[model samples]
Target: MLTDNQRGGIIAGYYLGHSCRAIAKVVGCHHSSVMSWPPAID
Candidate 1:
């Protein structure tokens, strides 16, 4: 599971034009996880 801070970072990274693979590296998750995360953000 991702922390609130990590989820926030992923969102920020996504909007900033970072790739899912790159964001996943920073957050320590898989690219697929990153790809699946945005829609579920709440």
Candidate 2:
């Protein structure tokens, strides 16, 4: 289970143009985990 801070960082990193693999590296999670996040609502 990801902490709130980890989830927030993933979301922020994604919006900031970081790739899922890159965000996973920073967040210490699997790339697939990052990719599994819900699509951003515009």
Candidate 3:
């Protein structure tokens, strides 16, 4: 599983306009995971 820092990295990258696939590649997770971040983060 990815650490919070890793997940935050994915969220930041996505917020920067990076594609879900790109964020997933950098964060080592599936693209679908991108949808579960950002908004779900508290």
Off by over 4 Å in 3: 18-42
Which tens-of-lDDT digit does each residue in 1-42 have in candidate 1? 999999888878666444665577788876564565465443
Could you give candidate 3's per-residue lDDT for residues 1-42 as a string of tens digits? 999999888778667545555567788886564545455443
TM-score of 3: 0.38
Task: Summing lDDT over every window of 10 consecutive residues in candidate 1, give the lowest-scoring window.
Answer: 33-42
Candidate 2 lDDT trough over 10 residues, lowest sum:
33-42
Candidates' TM-scores? 0.39, 0.40, 0.38
Cα RMSD, model 1: 9.0
TM-score-better candidate, 1 vs 3: 1
**Predictions: Cα RMSD each:** 9.0, 9.1, 9.4
Q: What is candidate 2's CA lDDT for residue 29?
A: 82
Query: Which sections of candidate 1 miss by over 4 Å?
Result: 18-42
**Per-residue accuracy of model 2 over 1-42 as CA lDDT, tens digit each:** 999999898778666544665577778886564465545521
Using lDDT, give the best candidate's number.
1
Q: Which stretches of candidate 2 lie over 4 Å from their true place?
A: 18-42
